[model samples]
Target: MKNKFTLILVLFLYINLVNCDYYQSKTIVPHDLPNKVTHLHFYYFDIHTGNNPSAVIVARPNQTNEKNPKKSSLYGTVFAIDNPLREGPEETSNVVGNAQGLYVSSSQSEDVTLTMYVDYAFTSGELNGSSFSVLSRNPVREPTRELAVVGGRGKFRMATSFALIRAHFLNVTTGDGIIEYNVTIFHY
Candidate 1:
C-alpha cells in the first residue's frame, strides 16, 4: 500500500509539472521610434545597360551610404536604434538590432509595386538574440503596411507574428529613411 501511494504521488506531481502554464499566450511588443536611423542598401540596374532588364536586384550588406554610385548593384546598412538615439547597442552606440532584408521593385511609375522581406533582431534587453522575419508589400510607399511575421528564434521560438510599418522619413533619391516598427507576436 505504501509503494502504491508513493507511485501515485509521483505521477500526480509529474502531471502537474507537465501541465504548468509557464509560457503564456499573446505577447505584444512595440518599438517606438522618435528618430531611428534606417540604414538601407539600394541596388539598381542600369536601364541603359540592359543587364538587368527587369530591374530586379537584391539589397544587401547592411550599411548607409548617401553617395552610393548609381551603377553599383550591391550595398549594406546598419540601423542604430535606441530610445533617444543615444543608448545605441552594447558593441556600438544605441543600435539595438537591425532591419535586414531584400527589396524587389516592379516599376518607377506612380503605381509603384514592391515586395520586401525584412528581419528584426534584438541585440540587448530581455529579448536579446530574439529575431522575427516579415514579408511586406509596398511598405515604403504605403502609409501603413502590415507585414506577416513568418517565424523567429531564441525567446521568440515558434513565433507567429505581424509588424506594422510606418515610414516617417524617406529620401526618395537616396532610398534611405527613418521608419517605425510596431510588432505583435504570439509565441510559446
Candidate 2:
C-alpha cells in the first residue's frame, strides 16, 4: 500500500512539473516581434484657467515594451494641433500656443528630431479677441521620430472663456518616454 501511495505521489509531482514548464515556455515565448509603442503621454488643458495662462505637457517612458521579442528601430516624434478662434468679451490678445524642448531619456540613444503639430476648429469672435496660433521653438532630439500633437477648439464666449487643448507624445521603447519635466508660468 505504501509503495502504491509513493508511486501515485511521484506521478502527480512529475505531471505538475511538466505542465508548469510547458505553460511557462508558452507564456515566455512571443509569436512575433513587439509593436513599437506609438503613443506615450498626453496633456489636456482648459484655456479658461486664469492668466498667467499656459499649458505644458511631458511624456514619460514605461518599461513593459523593452523585453518583447520583436521591436522596431526608434524614429522621430510627431504632434497634431487643433484650435480655433472664439467670440470673447474683449479683444483678448493672447498668443495662445507654443511648444518646445523635445528631449530624450538620459540613458537611451539620441539621434532623432521631435515634431509638433496643431489643428483646430475656427473660433468666431473679434479678430484679435478670438484667435489661435501654434509653434514650437526647438525640436527634441531622440532616437524615435514619432509625433506629439497639440491644439484646441475655437469660440470662447463668457460661457466658453477658454479652449480645450490636447497633446500627445510618443516613443520607440518603454524606456524612452520616462522623463522629468518642469512647467513654468511667467506673468508680467
Candidate 3:
C-alpha cells in the first residue's frame, strides 16, 4: 500500500512538472536603431524555423577562429539623412550595429534614403523556412510584396517580405535543417 501511494505521488508531480509552461515577457522587442536618423523605417525580411531542435541556428566567430572553415561573419548596412549643421563632415554613412548618430549639414537640408544589406552564414542540419510577423507599428495602407525561395545547397527556404515598417518574425520548419540569410533594405 505504501509503495502504491508513493508511486501515485511521483506520477502526479511528474505530470505537473512536464506540463509547466515555457514563457517569456509578452512585450515586443524592437530592433536596435541608429541615432542619426530624423526619420526611420524598418522592414521584414523572412520567417523561418527548424525541423528539430538541432537543426537551424545563427552564430558569430571569434577573431582567432576567423580562419577556420566552420567560422563565418555576418554583416548589414543602413542609410540616414545628411545634414550640414552637424559636427561630422561626411554627408552619409553606413549604419552598422551599435553605430551612433546621423549626419546633418548646416545650411543644406536633404531627405536621405538609406539602404541596408544583411548577410550571415551559420551551421544547421535541417531547416524549415523563414517567417515574418506584423507588429503594431507596421504601416497599414502600403502594398506588401511577399515571396518564398528555397535554397539549393542547404535544407533551407527563405520567405522574404517587404513591409514599410514591420519587424516581428517567426520561423517554422518542415524537417530538421539550418539556414543562413542574406537581407537587403533599400530606399530611393
Model 2: how far residue 160 lies from native, Å: 23
Report the lDDT tens digits of candidate 1 across residue range 1-188.
99999999999999998898876665665433122222221121112113322222333454344565454332232222212111311224455565555556543344445666656666666666877666656535778777777877776676676767666555566554455566677765
lDDT, candidate 3, 39-83, per-residue tens:
223222221232322222232223343456573322211113111
Model 1 CA lDDT for position 154: 79
User: Which regions of candidate 1 deviate over 4 angstroms?
Assistant: 1-93
Candidate 1: C-alpha lDDT: 0.52
Ranking of predictions according to TM-score: 1, 2, 3
TM-scores, each model vs. reference:
0.50, 0.20, 0.16
What RMSD, rounded to one decimal, does every model reach?
A: 13.8, 19.2, 21.2
What lDDT score is found at residue 41 in candidate 3?
30
User: Residue 126's C-alpha lDDT in candidate 1?
Assistant: 65
Better of 1 and 2 by TM-score: 1
